[model samples]
Target: MMNGWIISAAAEIFWREENKMAEARSLEEIKLDYAWKFGCGRYIQQREALETLPEEIKRLGDKPLIIAGPRAWEATEGRIEKALREAGIEYVLSVYPDQNTYEKAREHASQAVSSGCDVIVGVGGGRIMDQAKASAYFAGEMTKARSGHFPVVQVPTSIATCAAFAPLSVMYTQEGASLGSLRHNFEVNAIVVDLDVIVKEPARYVASGILDGMAKMVEMQNGHDNITIEEFDVGLVTAFTLAKYTMETYRKRGVQAVEDVRAGKLTKEVEDITYLNIAVAGVISGCSKGFGQTALGHECYELIRTHFTQEAKDFIHGEIVAVGQSMQLSFNGQEDQIPALREMMNSFDMPLTLKDIGIEPTEENVETLYQDLYHSPFVKDCPEEAEKLRKAMKWLCE
Candidate 1:
């Protein structure tokens, strides 16, 4: 079953060299013209910037629709409403509790359009961001395949995923649980990050974001074996580079870097990490140029299919992806690395094993993963050289 693609000494050398060249390429050096503006003329990071929201809204034109998760509205609604009132801007509020369900997307859009919403502001985590983005699409900001239709302002409460600036949305069934598919209707006109709000969350969530950032690199690299150099996609390259930088940033700084976040201290390093996770990573994923080249943790999708209940999917996206990344490493025949990876998971208090996440490795669970493996699209995309990965996964679970 070994495809005879041996990892000889030379192979490692080649991998190291290629990876080095790939890492050296910068987002600016590439021709992606979309300047993902992160800060508040549209995006405000501080209370002063937020205080100026009224003035800014006056400039951006009149009617605005505030699309956000319940949590986002709960946390900042009063301040937002107060700012709107003081600014004399007319706006309506729409709460998006779910992602890509047809009914939910329709409801949000209809509400915003009916309110004569000319500008859209999305506040909160990835799910809310996605719902806002999808609703904007329905509101005629742009078609699903075109550039943005209307201006959008995004304020991220969590740094856990790249959803804030990305044009893409991960729609879920209504009630906010099951995931549908990745979507890209339009990109954000601006991204606002309040370090204070972000820092207030558990440190573990921040660490999980770091892990998600790292996975962007890991999954993209794993996807590259399927491409040629001329065919090399910018999105994949950007994702890989972002991941590399973010991983190194976390690996070196450890808890102190995260501590700074918890303390609302925005260091140069923290900004870099946050930008990578939010802006750069989002652009890479949202843009069509990178969509085909990117590989997700598809195996995790299958595993979740076997275990995910409506109630469980409500957890943070990073939590699922953290476990997915661990699953990806294991599926790659890197069993020896599990202990190290597990340690990494434990450092963030992430669920380290199937058992930890509440999916016990019982006989039925083992059979399910094996049956699903044969049909896995992610497996199909793996290099012929890595075909043994399928067998390895089966053997490991056995």
Candidate 2:
């Protein structure tokens, strides 16, 4: 009688466990029912790629508005004008200020509307593209235009960020502080990546871009355990594969590619690197839809930007992010990976310590940083993890 009772209890426990597993699987399937949208319908990346812009512009419309930064305009004005003239396409040019703010976006949108422009072409770095995207979006809303009818084309002058193909724009305050990001359903009509134009900039931009691309992969890898099997669809898998390719390309040919660009020589390696930096990086983030939620490195950046404005202004996006990645690795108790990460960053003169980013290792500053990190949304779901990250940051400063 005692043996029979024990057997009955074991079977009940096994049944309950199986039920729990089935429930979890059902939940994941429900989540997968939602679909994600991918932006940037067309991508033209190659040397002399600007030559292809006339065809793209013709497809969008006859009346086009060109939005660009002052310096970026100076660099590409000749090619753009020549192309437009040859194609007999009339365009209005609007040069935006250095800042990337909502007000600026609205101002550009007003210009696009008043000028009777049918298509918006953003020609510059990330900020310019972001402004153009926002302008096109708001312009369409104001005019009561159909969705996706008022198209925007992104022509990237630098590979610093994925703004060229991303459907979102990162907003900032008038004081040059980050406000957060804004998402739009509008898709970029096309992307023209002229390697000749991009290589004209310094090699530092390329290196920073590569690191930014790598960060997306690192974030995904760090949070792999949390992602469900249902989330591992073709888009997610392709994103992961692209991230890996970006890292491998950088490790194998990045140094020489930089040298070739510095010498004003555009090689196949440079073209491949640029492709990895812009398209691959952009697509990964676009498809994943912030799957890993930026992990520790980006969280640190947000904290510092919010609290230590003066110190944060001196560093570019990717430079500070590299330091944050190192801190994140340490936070996760993956100290063994730190040496290689630091070495790669150091080779490009990226910051590896607090002082490197212009922050003193004073106790007061460290405490402030810790407090900012503690209250960040990245740790909102798990407050205890914030403490762990704060300790890791403290050790980094020390």
Candidate 3:
């Protein structure tokens, strides 16, 4: 369904142009025509979740290309390889660089084509998941594929973000500014999460995952925070409801989830929290169109991410988003909820201030954040809005 109807290299050029054009357009102009890949990831949370991989892969493609970082591959390779071999499935293993960049996606896409791999399996956190999805999408343009993507299977090794279940890859510059998202009309062919594997990771991953999932509620509801839904996109309404429920669930059970993950034990709280981070948050992201799901908090993350790369070296996307959430809660005048959120973050050792993350609120740095927010093309340029961002960020740093 290309507008100009080209293929191969021509299609590739057209795709890049299309992305730029999308970035240029307003959210109101972009339309989604009934896009949902899957309800969420298929659930099989036992110690044997990898056992289902062979069946899932065979359902989509005969040859699979597994994408991962070295550590992620090392952690799950034994189980993953065992499952595939027993089922007589031939698979290719490719490791992405530690640097998550578009060029790497292009490199992997070319590999997918040359290796003749029919499906992609992302076997890690957000970076690997996004790269695999992006590579599959780009490979569709590289070839004359009908759906413009090879089927993707997501196997989440950590609960950092919902890239595993989201219909789009969160795009970023090599230097870490947001380039919006690479949205897919199709969903991943399947998703598999093994709790035993996920629980062994650091508790911070689970905590960060919770914060990232919570962003869906905070950012999406800034404009449409109404509980009594009247008239709207059914998908949008549905996503809002899910986020609300997820938030309440977190309020009740998230602490326990984090503690259990820290203790390297699987429990109901851990399971629900893990799914909320991947599936529920992902649905919220997939249902959102254009900037419909973005607001001051998310925008703040994009606007300031590159500023403190040194300080943020060990940081994940959700941790930075937590800082932005402060700006959002303040800017949107949702001040009453701040105390509880602040307390929770403090308890989890999550950053509640710029200093907490090793970022200084020096005059020069603070002004940069303020100026970027003030001049952002995404938001209305007004003194009041600028002041709010300033106040919010200032409070966060202080």
Choose 1 or 2, whichever is better by TM-score.
2
**Per-residue alpha-carbon lDDT of model 2 for 224-309, expressed as tens digits?**
43234566666666666767677777889877777787788888878888887777777777776533325567756655665566
Better of 1 and 2 by lDDT: 2
Candidate 1 TM-score, true structure as reference: 0.76
lDDT of 2 at 154: 88
**How many backbone clashes are present in model 2?**
0
When sorted by TM-score, best at the front, the candidate numbers are 3, 2, 1
Candidate 1 lDDT by residue in tens digits, 1-398: 00111134643344334222221122333233243322223444553344555565556558878877788777664777887887778888777665545456667777766767777778788767766666666666333324445556777777787777665555444444333343443456666676656656566667767777666655665434432346665544544555566667667764565777667676765666666667656655643243332333534542453245443454466666666665565555455756765576676677654555556667786555545543444455345634555544432332
Runs with alpha carbons beyond 4 Å of true place in candidate 2: 1-35, 223-238, 290-293, 380-384, 395-398
Candidate 3 TM-score over all chains jointly: 0.89
Maximum-TM-score candidate: 3
Q: Let me know the TM-score candidate 2 reaches against the reference structure.
A: 0.84
Worst 10-residue lDDT window, candidate 1: 18-27
For all predicted structures, in order, the TM-scores are 0.76, 0.84, 0.89
Off by over 4 Å in 1: 1-48, 55-60, 98-100, 141-148, 175-179, 223-231, 261-269, 286-307, 331-338, 381-387, 390-398
Q: Which number leads on lDDT?
A: 3
Instruction: Write down the RMSD of candidate 2 (Cα, Å).
Output: 11.8
lDDT per model vs. reference: 0.57, 0.70, 0.74
Poorest lDDT segment (10 consecutive residues) of candidate 3:
1-10
